[model samples]
Target chain A: MVETGLKLCLKQDHPIKLDINLRCQNNEILALVGPSGGGKSTVLRAIAGLYPIQQGYISCQQELWLDTVNTINRPTHQRAVGLVFQNYALFPHCSAQENVAMSLGHLPKNKRLQQAIILLEKVHLKGLEQRYPRQLSGGQQQRVAVARALAREPKILLLDEPFSAVDQVTRRRLYKELIQLRDSLAMPIILVTHDLDEANLLADRLCLLYHGVSLQSGTPMEVVTSPATAQVAKLMNQQNIFVGKIVAHQPKKNISLLSWHDRLIEVGYQSGYDLGERLCWMIPETDVILHRRYQVSKGERENPFSGIIIDYMLLGGYVSVLIEIDKKRKMKLTMSVPLHVARRNGLKKGIVITVTLLTKGIHLMPFESLR
Target chain B: MDWESLLLSIKLSTLTVIFLLPVGIILGRYLAYRQFYGKSLLQALLAIPLVLPPTVLGYYLLVFLGQSSSLGRGLEALFGQTLVFSFEGLVIASIIFNLPFAIQPMQRAFESIPREIREAGACCGLSPIKVLLKIELPLAWTGIISAMVMTFAHTLGEFGVVLMVGGNIPGETRTIAIAIYDRVQAFDNQAAATMSAFLLIFSVIAISFTYLVTERHKKYYG
Candidate 1:
């Protein structure tokens, strides 16, 4: 059996080019998370066959939707795909029952109403069947939209920011309903949204898009904890990204040497690579341990570095110190020092500090372009 | 009592509306959604009758279709008929005269509908025709209805074209507008006022009710 990929590389020059390349799993929900105007919705629209593309192919469950080379573009209805639009474009004149029933035009009339009612009931919109779109509130209308899309029993469900407008309580309830569907339906779900929290809650794998390109695509943890690129790191809201250079590929010793400014450090790398390659390294906030003085430690995997705190911010529970290292080029690190230690030591903006970065906590992704 | 002319004018307007409504909708929908060459010229041409003196249009109709011409002969021979001083002739003239009234509102309505909505319909596997039937037509019904009524009412009040080409027949080409003029010229104010009053009251009530129905949809649908 062959795999079907939802692929796109189009630029009507409509804001963003919407270049996405992903093969959705049969049953897993693939959530796309990004900032506003980062082209999250553009990718969703392209997959739905709404946006015209340039030189791309899309196939779902091995069925070809679009093949630019072959000039094959299946009409959207023929695609049998479902979508719960952002605005829930419910037919205003029709009641919820009739609206759901509209999706079942291919079904027999007797079965259409019954099927529509069942789908509506699945979305918890049973009693509101006779109500028109105007009569429904924002959240209620969103549920109806989902029901109508599912009424078709489509091959894949594409939701374009469905819960963006709903209240938090209603959004939570909606997520529960979606989670139930996740366990039951083998139909792949692709939800596009700008909210990271929504992605964390809904997506098994998160795909991030930025300015018409797939910045990163991986499980939520992989993208957040150990992002692959600087763009991915920025999109994931990582505070500290410092430039480092590879020093030694000590394979026998199981420790790769990296130089952070003038200080030499040893960190773990899954593979040994060439030397002098410029790399971007990340020190997660949880990794940095603050100290009262410029202390030295030996016989430990933790590497120590010294710098004066250029700026300090008192967060709720942690103190963030912005440290500048004197290298040939300026290097800044956002080291989150716990507040308890700060209070005990009375650390200030001009205070000289020593911080230890654990070998395990250091993430290294090669930035080849920077060199 | 020139009741036949009055009745004929009402029939003419009614028939014109019936034929022109769909034509207007198709034209409007196409123009609003699709961009092609000479669009501005075509739109201006469609609205020509609204601005041009009806007498000029009537004369042009006669020039191309008068009995003496080969074109007129060809039409007469092809259909065993002529389109001058005939009821069919007046109907044709009225359709052309009131074309813009049927088209403008419908175009505005189609323009107002979001293209994303059409794309949404298309993504649901609705073909262009299906999108038009399901999404475009129903949504644009208010403007369509307004177009029909306005065109029909405008045709009802037409005079100059019928006078130039119609020759005031008793029960055929002589419409109410022509009859009013004829009554006024003959110094028959009573009959003229009677026709005028009927025309005024009927048009006012019809237009008022059309506005009411259209406005009701706007208020309730949103």
Candidate 2:
């Protein structure tokens, strides 16, 4: 029963409980993104057959790796999985070539070393093949681990925070290498990480998890901007999550009216919710457009509001400004603008500013307490 | 020194180490990685030989393998011989007495390996036996060697258990330690001194070799 993808549905309540359902097509990269202790790594371990689930059905390429009802479970080595651990657990006593060669046991003995050398070169570690894990730098050791994992030419690849140990610069370089490598790999790849930015940059789709429960799975931007629930919104770092009521839906104008405290915001058509229904809504910081102080702009005409700057922080080239829109409600909105734009507008604490929330970016979710 | 007794001691120590090597590895790895019911109790029971008087352990072994017990009688029926007062009996007692010496260092070594290394081995498609041979055994060799040395040295010097279970039979159970005691009992101080000095030197060399190898391994791999 050989197919071309992976499907894993697992449920367990004891001993590191988790509920996860995930799928990946051939050549797809799915990122399991969540907070620490959110069972992202556990999911990877389960897929790799290192962790046992009390009840589950796991199949790779339509071959059953685990089926609890039938009492069929394959041991880790029998499953065609290549897993890169967070610590890059390269054999300390083995050289980089030996580490990669260890995984090439399926090949002829004489060809193992040549294949390992090729894999090491693929990871840009050709000259360092003789170095032991202890002798290599963290980044080099990580590359050796990746080479070792890929040496098996496994049916699936699992990466558990593969870039977390390296410095930021090295991490960026590894991310680029992995992205380049993915094009050559036809197997499904699942990555576990707490870094949303890493997922956004490297993964084709992101699966959001919280406390071992998968909340949503979608493209990076969709999950970030149109989270299915408040929890997903919070997990995505959407700072503008708020509870609002659908005051009206104007079908003729293809618009909806959302009442946030004393304000009426014009949003894109949301057809499902009844009038006066309470719902959770969020707007991404990218969708909050800062109005030019010196000159008015046409983009400012949609969902325009004035607020006073409560806080502002410069992050690299962008300035994140938190503005309080309602003094009595203590409601605030966060927006990011380039540093040059902030400076030109004289943005600072206690300064009054006007911003427009894009009508299409006001995403709505079913009512849930923002606890 | 009684060359016959010294040779007997060497044979006994070598046999004990041979038998305990696999036992120590299997038990040590089990203790290192698993959690189960009665695990602590099993560990405490295994450690009794380290703290309890050798005579106490010997008394139990003597009774368990003596002629009056069913196990001893069954063994005698099967082999047409008694186990007590024999070289085989002495080896068994020595192995039991050196259990901690044979297992603790290896257990600590196995524990020192991070869990992810073994998982990585599995993920790399190495079978469990291959992982143990290519990954765990190489990493834990220092502790395994230490265990062997400690077990050999301890088996060579055991006195009370040998006396109780093997009954001072010359050329059979009269180890170097018992021979030293016998020489002293016979008012032969010079002979006792010779055997005692030999054992002292052998022990020093064995312990020093273990320490040197362990220190070198740590420096190279720590």
Candidate 3:
């Protein structure tokens, strides 16, 4: 069991206080996803011993890394942890092979270079030994950074957005290599990224942080389907956030009936609820179906939400539609169906549309202010 | 106006430069990395020698390190030496006079480096000493060298501190400035001209070397 609770304080103009209490299971990649400057990187830095913590303790595998009361603050070099920087930060002065050899401590002078070569090969950076950082491409530098970190043989690795500097194609390939690396190693790696897709595909457990607080943390599906608050839902890019309350609830059932403002919006949920209790309905964008008329669903099992299209973004691979509800609220839905669905149905702004929330994708989460 | 005294002054300055280079670099690195409550106070203290009257500093050192004091007695007991009226005393006086000239630039050099680079080294599990030896020192070379050159020039050209501590002992404490003053006092204009010529040549070489090194660094960084 791995448990760590830390209060992170950064030295900006005002100290950013992030309290992270997490029990990350062994061998799980816990991805902390959040908005920019939300202290996602702070938590990673604190755990990695790159940032100072003000209060609480960090323990991994029953071994303490930090304890304020005990005053056990092990410096980074002695902590035996691996850290991959955001920019990769491969030494500009050193060659790729030498970069990895730096962490292979106290090895015989001649044997160190050979050992670094083996580690470089593991990262697929073959034959790039003599190449300096400036000579390597963004993707190759990232590989070198990972290889150098792996040379330390750390029990836990911390990566801070390793792919943000690369192009889309390179990022996809690096992500693949990272997954392969994880499978072959048993050490738990904590990754921080803003990409929802990356978080879902790469994480065994997803930790969503917002405004310097861990708002919600659970399995990727749990956080994705039921974000703890409206801010997290927004971070997840949920299609619709309805200001509603529990209209009817079955005591034995986990899900309860909800009404959005005045209209009834049926959703399938598995959380306790009290009737007349105020809450928010989170409907997935993929679950929203765009239609010309309200009869798109044949049966009454359909829960249609009436709204006007506020925006229609025709991205090359997908379409993002923002619907204005009752001329007051907004809903952003993403769809990637055939073009004929919108063209044949004449989907346009100021036009009424009936959308069904794939009930399995719909979730009613309680609302609370984090600030 | 004696030629030998002026040449001897040049000798003392050259020796002074040789001793202060390593000392200044280490002190600069320490001041940059150490974070204590009195850091600012210490910095001001390090810089005071540069701004204070050279005679005042010499007078203070003379009393504290004189033969009558415990420190002077302890030094004599350990090494059988005294600082008064000795070449060693001149070296010590020059080092103190030009210390800020050597350290201020080096401290600024270390300061301009991005903290992330050192942190990156630390995160890579490099020891603090390794970080200093491998990353910090290499990055701060330009400043360190410039500081060395400035210290060398200042020590070579020192007048007031050497005047207070040095009693113009022929071939011992009589530096080029003292030689020039003695010649002028005796109305020996021609000897003064020759000594001035020697000082002029040394100044040109030192100043030109400083300019050349600085230009190369500018081009390299640009």
Best by DockQ: 2
Better of 1 and 3 by DockQ: 1
* DockQ versus reference, model 2: 0.83
- Distance (Å) between predicted and true CA of A108, model 1? 1.8
State each model's CA lDDT, in order.
0.80, 0.91, 0.75
Question: What lDDT does model 3 reach?
Answer: 0.75
**Top model number, TM-score:** 2
- Sorted by TM-score (best first), the order is 2, 1, 3
lDDT of 3 at B43: 87
A117-177 per-residue lDDT for model 3 (tens digits): 9989888888889998878899999999998888888767788898899999998898888
Poorest lDDT segment (10 consecutive residues) of candidate 3 chain A? A5-14
Provide candidate 2's TM-score on chain A.
Answer: 0.97
Better of 2 and 3 by TM-score: 2
Supply the TM-score of chain A against the true chain A for every candidate structure.
0.81, 0.97, 0.86
Against the true structure, candidate 2 reaches a TM-score of: 0.97
Better of 2 and 3 by lDDT: 2
